[model samples]
Target: MQDRIEITVTDGVADVRLVRSDKMNALDAAMFKAIEEAGEQLRNDPSVRVAVLSGEGKAFCAGLDMANFAAMAEGGKSSEHKGGAKAVPKTLAERTHGIANQPQYAGWMWRELPMPVIAAVHGVALGGGLQVCLGADIRYAAPGTRLSVMEIKWGLVPDMAGTQLMRHLLRDDVVRELSYSGRIFTAEEALTMGLVTAVVEDPYEHAMTLARQIAGRNPDAIRANKRMFNAANYLSAEDGLMMESVEQDAIIGTPNQIEAVMAELEKRPAHFKD
Candidate 1:
């Protein structure tokens, strides 16, 4: 996985980078597997308070590799192989990884992580790349970075959990227009459309600084806040209120919570445990 993706944890922040800059970090079979594996690794690690994702070199990601498209055009399966043999291709409707398939999980896995994930997007994020960015809890993009729901250009839909993620972030009409047109939009426009959290001159640096600030807070409360927000996205108003109460109830009297209050009273940074 390190060949395609690299992860380094510092002060509870996981810095994840896509290293396939030679190909603009395009999603090939190996890249797909690497991304999923990276997410799984971070998900299982109790020490990771937050994660910042970025791509090395020019572009964040250029989406699906052109080779895969060529393979599909020639009637070859674009699926990955397992072990020493080619794995049988599964239908899109099949749920191979919980609620998502293999390819979709590459993007959706970030959302499954217990801690928040921030994406620092630069250059271009199209099709699958854009879907991956959507999976992050927060996204910061460099000014003028290009983005799109570009699967339509290749005669496909945004199947990598893009529709599910986008609907929550954008209006129905905006989603339809972007999905149908496959037109490139700049980060400034994405900020107006609510696709990106902010457009800045240096996204990675900004993301890391925010990650450090979040890491200094009470870990349990930060995690509970993320869980509550994620559930609120799909829960009923009553259920959402109950969830908030439940999460707050669990954290109110905890050691870390007390530490947070004491830290503020004492004018010192809280030291939270993993």
Candidate 2:
């Protein structure tokens, strides 16, 4: 079988692409495992300063595979455990992978990465695909890209960390309406709704440019900022302020931090050490 995901790291930026273009990169059991493994690979590589995620072909992703849904409709098993063993039926409430289940981990892992992640979305990002995009710290979409909270159409909800991610990016009512309707929205509409950072002619190219810019910053500081921002959503104002100070204290006067200052004074591009 062809690899579901492909990763290439260059100049501190890991280019992570979903390679199942034939299926619009839809999530199947193997695709889920591949995504999770890709995230973990980048997490362990200290040399990676940033990541840009995109799909290989026409679409970013088309959400869950239709076969899985068909199986569900037929009341037949739709997935299996690793190593091809039959999967033991389990409740969604089960936390199989930290705070998420197998499916949720596919997207949530991107958010959990220490380095920044930027999603380059094009074509369609439906249901679970949108959830995967939401996991990124930032998202860029092509001008006519289509998106939706599409699970409702399949008599389901966004179970792949979409609720947790959408609540933070969009207003409560907006998220509720989208979830209830499962309506497809354009990239322009998504930008207005705060679902996308920008809608450009070429999202992947723009995302790579931004990724390279971010990769040039002091790696320690960048990672620290990601950590602080991730915690900000859950922390009180007092704790948030304290975290700022803590992260600053750890980064201040460090080798990479000093290099950043020196490069600025020298008027040369910063040469950051991963």
Candidate 3:
């Protein structure tokens, strides 16, 4: 229903796209709202077993709007909130939404969703755009797609859930190098660096195909697997293994799991319930 963001769901897959192309899908205030709402929609859509995030036009996003940066430089608040007489946007350190604030939530929400979310990145996924892609479970990018952690160039750090996500995805040295330099890198290098799942000539097509494959699987098992995997990332090895056992215990012998086995035995696809 949002204008800046568009969603089209078909056959259990939701394609969520950023539609502002004129400025290469720059992040204006409206975009922030659109992204948040889009994520929320996919999260709640029971029929959506998988989601693909992509941008329309020539680029993914060019990061923050220049005017926003200029205003921040001039001592204006990035968000409009009030505390007594003074208003302040929530800082990055404060995880307003369980490891991210509202702005960062736009990216982080996708990671927390039950189903898989794939980013189909094209030209220029810089700063926040890169952060957005980091939120996805997987990233598919065009070979020449340009990506960077560009906040440093603007005298800002990457405060949009990027730091947390990168900690899991990149090596300590690689993270430090990219964050310090703010240099743009190609999608090919990103794949090698583990920033992308794969490189393709047409990233969107590849993403859709991947999404379809996931959507055809057992939804309940997929959600359980994602939860277990995410839990493993934050817990100790022993505790993570314990948690996986707990998750499996809860799902094993459930109707959907039974359906999954039956479908496999029947040489047909599963029809899992959400």
Candidate 4:
């Protein structure tokens, strides 16, 4: 990975860091590319049972770089890639990765990954940065961290998987309030409003600690749980319950399941299937 982003995988956990501290880890073309690459790499790596994403700077990310905004104001041609080199499908509804195109895939891909992804948020997570965090299965935020759906301030809508993720996390009115007002909120407020998984003094540390715990679990079972939970969001409660039963049945008495039970009974760590 480029210096703009750091990707490290060890002990079945991948830690992906955005390293543009000098720029507050702002989203530029380079950062977008790096994030996309990192997500793809983790997706393809079967050994990675969990992943943590965070920024190495005073902030997580400060949305779009000023230079890009300045160029747009000057009526420069839009540099946004139209799904990269991938050929467009005949109908938008038929695209494979749901509503995501190539640029959006950078954020959406994290959500689609079978294993859990955690976002360690600190300082500020605004616009595109916040959207990226939303893609994660869980968000760990620093106590005083600021978050926002701030695209309205830039005269643009969040185009990086924000809408879809917000829909899953916030009530309709709550989503509208955040998106329409472009207001920034503290981590405490985020926790109260269900925007973050937890508020901590050190988000990255908390996230990694959680990742390690997850890494010690039965990998196959954990992934199956994630899949069922993801499906639950779009399915009726009854249907979701049925799906859960089906998933549980698939894992019961399986090697990983038996290992998990044996580990618990023996007071030892699980030796799970990758």
Worst lDDT run of 10 residues, candidate 2, spans 81-90
Q: In angstroms, what RMSD does candidate 1 have relative to the true structure?
A: 1.7
Ranking by lDDT: 1, 2, 3, 4
Q: In order, how many clashes per candidate? A: 0, 0, 0, 0
Q: Residue 91 deviation, candidate 3, in Å?
A: 5.0
Estimate the TM-score of every prediction. Answer: 0.96, 0.96, 0.92, 0.90
Q: What is the lDDT of residue 228 in candidate 3?
A: 83
Tens digits of lDDT, candidate 1, 1-274: 8878999999999999999999999988788888878988998999999999999999999998887788768676655443222232446688878999977897888888899999999999999999998999999999999999999998889999999999999999999999999999999999999999999999999999999999998999889988988887899999999998888999998899999999999999888888
Once model 1 is optimally superposed onto the true structure by TM-score, how far is the C-alpha of residue 205 displaced, in angstroms? 0.1
Q: Can you write out model 4's per-residue Cα lDDT over 156-244, one digit (the tens) per residue?
A: 78777788888889898999999999999998999998999999988899999999999999888889989997887799989998998
Candidate 2, 1-274: lDDT as tens digits: 2379999999999999999999999987778878878877998999999999999899999998887787778675656734352232346788878999878887798899999999999999999999998999999999999999999998988999999998899999999999999999999999999999999999899999999999999999999999999999899999999999999999999999999999999999998777
Runs in model 1 deviating more than 4 A are 78-88
- Candidate lDDT scores, in order, read 0.90, 0.90, 0.84, 0.83
Candidate 3: regions farther than 4 A off = 77-95
Predict model 1's lDDT versus the native. 0.90
Candidate 3 weakest lDDT stretch, 10 residues: 81-90
Query: Cα RMSD (Å) per model?
Result: 1.7, 1.7, 3.0, 3.4
Model 2 compared with the native: what TM-score? 0.96
After superposition on all CA atoms, how large is the RMSD of candidate 4?
3.4
